[model samples]
Target: MTTVNADAATPTELNVLVRPLPDYPDAERAYSRSSSLLWRRSAGAVEILHPWTERTISDSVMVASLSELVELGVLSGQEQFEDAAVQMICSSAASEESAWRAYYLNSINELDNGTSPFSPVHRRARSLIAGHEVLEVGCCFGFFALACARDGHSVRACDISPGAIDLLTTASASLRIDVDACVGNALALPYPDDHVDTVTLIHLLEHLDVQDTTVAVTEALRVARHRVVIAVPFEEEPTEHFGHLLRLTEDDLRLWADRVDHAGAEIFTDHGGWLILTPHR
Candidate 1:
C-alpha cells in the first residue's frame, strides 16, 4: 500500500480508508506460539473471548497497571480473555493458525484498547514534535498513531504487515482522524530524505534478525529531518521463535546516535530504554 501525501503539489484526493482491506495470509508466519501472560495480573481467571468486555481487561490493575489511551471497538466487552483464549486454543485444535490468532488478539488488545502496557517512548517524542509530521514504524494497530492524531499532529503509520496497516487505517476513519497508513519496510523505507519531522521505532528494532540491524536505523535517520526516537526492552531475554532477537543497553543507543553525528539520550526506565536523537547541525 502507498501513502497519499496530503501536501503533494498536485493536491490529489485519496480515500484510503475506503480502500479494500488487506487479507493477511502471512499472519500464521507472523504469529507467536509461546504465551506471555502467565503471571499478568487481571480482574479474573482465563475465560472465553466473546463475552469479555474492555472493562474486564483494564478495570483491574492485575492485567496491567496502565489505562488504555482510547476506547477499542474490537472486544465484546464481556469476559476474561484468558478463558476465551484457551477456547481458541482448543477450537483451532492447537494449530499454528490458532496460536497466531490468539497471540495477536491478546497483543493487539493490550496496546490498542486506548491503553498501553509499554511506556517511555512517547515521554520525549511528544515534546520534540513542535507541530511536525510523525512517522511510526511497526505501528501495530496504530494506538500511538491515534494518540498523536488526538494531540493534533499529522500522523503516518507503517508496518510490513498488511493486516496491521489496513486495520489501523480503518480505525482512524472510524475515529474521524486523518492519517496515512501504509505497508513499509523498516530496512528500506519508502519515504524520501528528511520527509518527516520525527521517526519512531517503538519496541521495533530488536525484532529484526541479527543481520538487518543497521539498515532499519539507517533508514529511520535518512527519513527524519529533526528527531529520531527508538525504544526497546532493556536487557531483554529473547523469546522462542517469534520475539526479540537481542538485548540492547544504553551504550548501544549511544553508539547508534554517534554514527549520525547527533547527540542523544539513553534514558533508562523500569519499562525500557528510550533513546532520542537529533540531527547534526
Candidate 2:
C-alpha cells in the first residue's frame, strides 16, 4: 500500500488546472517498465498498460462483465432509477468470487468514460486526500476509497444504494483492500457536523436531481471539519444517454461552495473540473 510521504503536507485545497494530454506524463517510461513485465501493456493502440496480473484489476474486463450483467436483466426495471441497478450488477459481479476479470467491470467503465476516479482531476485530488480522514459520498465502486486506503488514509465510503456498498464490501475483502463501506444518501447523509476532516464526492453531482444539488452539498459540507472536494464534468455536453441532470462549470461549483461563509473555494479544470472547499482558519 502507498501512503502519503511524511514530507507531503496536508492539503486544505487542490487547484490543478489541466487540459487533455496526448499521453499521460510518463507513458513511455511506464510502458517500458510494463513491457518488461513490471507491468503489461494492453494490446490496443491506445497503449493502456496493465500492471502485473495480481497487482491491479484491469478496466475493460470489468466494463464488459458489468454490461453483460445488465443485459441479463440484473438491473431491469431499475433502469431509470438512480444507480441502484448499476449497483446491483456490481454486487453480483463481486459476489461471483471470480478472478479480477469478472469483478471489476463497473470500475473500468467509469474510469474509461471519465465519470469517476482515475481522471486527471482525481490525480490532483490525491494531494488533498493524502493525510486526511475522509468520508466519501456516493462512492460507487469505492475506487477512490480503495485508492485512499492504498495511500494509507482512513476512509469511509457510503452510498445511497445498499447494492453499491455491498459490492464495495465484497471488493474490499476479495482484493484485501481496507475501506469502510455503508449505505447513505447524497441528499441526507447520515453523519454529524464535522464528522471527518474532509468529505469528498467524485463524478456524482451531475447525476443528482437538480433540486437536490443544494441539499446534497449542504449535507456534505456540514459534516466535514476541514473541507469538501468534488469533481464533475466540465461544461458537459447535453445528453440523457447517462442520467446527468446538469453539466457544471466552476461558477456552478462556486454556488455550492458559497453556502458556508467560512469556506473558501478553488477550481481546477482538467479532463473535467475539480472543486475544493477549504475552511478558513
Candidate 3:
C-alpha cells in the first residue's frame, strides 16, 4: 500500500488513509495471505480488490482503527508485519520522536516538521489540563497522550482497539516514554472515579452517537478529579472516510454541559469544537 496525500489537489490523486507497506520479505509473505486483496490504483482512487469476491472493500470498511483495517484484509495481522512497520519507521530517524513526526508528516500532507493536524487543539488541551495526572480516552495512536507525557505529565491512554493500544505500547517503549497504555472503551473506561486529574476525549465524540457521546462524557467526568475535556470536529456533514458518525457543533457540546453537573464549562473553537468541564467538588 502507498501513502497518498489526503489533500492532494489533483483530481486523479487517490486520497486514502494508508500506511507504507514494509519492504522486508517477511512483511511481503504476510501480505500474500490477505484473502487475495490487492491495492489497485485507478483513475479516481486506490481500490482494495478481492479477486474471489470481484468487489472492492470500500465504505463498508471502517478506517477508524488500525485493527479494523486489519480485519478488512487491508493490513496484515502477523507479528512480523508490526515489527517490520516499526523497523521501517525507526531505520533512519535519529530518535523515536523524530521518526513518528516524519511518519505523520508523510501520512498527513498538511503536517510539517513542527506541526500536526492536532497540534493547535493539543496546545489548547494541554493549556486547559487541570493537573499533571492525565488520562486520554479514545487515544487512537496515543499521540496526544505521548505529547502530554513529554510535557512532564503523568499520562495514561486507552482505546477500544487492541491493535492501536499494542502499537502505542510498542512505540512508547521504543521512544523511552513512560505511558500507561491499555485497551479500553469510551462508554466504559477501565479507570475508577476521580482516578486522574483530567480526562480528555480528543476527536472522539464524532465517532459516537448522541447517547454514547453522553455516556462517554459522563464516564470521562466520573473519572476526572478536576476536569473533563472533549473535542470534536465541526464538520457540515460527518466524514465517512474517517468513520465520523455525527457532525458535532458548539450547541451539541453545550447540551452536555447542561446535562452534567460541573463547576464550570467552557465551549470554544480552535481548529475544532473544544469543551472543558470542571467537575463539581
Best candidate per lDDT, number?
3
Pick by TM-score: which candidate is best? Answer: 3
**All candidates' lDDT scores?**
0.55, 0.59, 0.66
**Model 2 clashing residue pairs (backbone):** 34-39, 62-105, 63-105
How big is the positional error of residue 221 in model 3, measured in Å on the Cα after superposition? 0.7
User: Which lDDT tens digits does candidate 3 get at residues 1-281?
Assistant: 44434453332233332233332334443333233333433445433322211121111121223333344433443342244344445432546566554543343222222334455777788888988899999988777787788789999999998978986787678677789999999999998889999999999999888888889998998899999988888999775545679988889989988988788999998898989999876
Poorest 10 consecutive residues by lDDT, candidate 2: 11-20
lDDT by residue (1-281, candidate 1, tens digit) is: 11222343221121111000123333334322112121111122211112122223221222321111001111112232332333433233235344343333444355444354453345445555634699998886676776677778889889998977876776677666677999999998989888888888888878887557567887887888888778877765643222467777777666666555554544555467777777542
Tens-place lDDT per residue, model 2, 1-281, is: 11222343222122111111232566555532311111111321112222213223344333433333233322222232223323323233223355332435445345535655354555666667623688889888677787777667888989987877887898888777778899999888888877888888888898887678878877877888888888888654633434567877878777877665555778778767787876553
- Poorly placed runs, candidate 2 (over 4 Å): 1-57, 60-95, 99-102, 105-117
Off by over 4 Å in 1: 1-51, 54-116, 119-121, 128-130, 240-242, 261-270
**Every model: Cα RMSD to truth:** 16.1, 15.4, 10.8
Q: Compute the lDDT of residue 166 as modeled in candidate 2.
A: 84
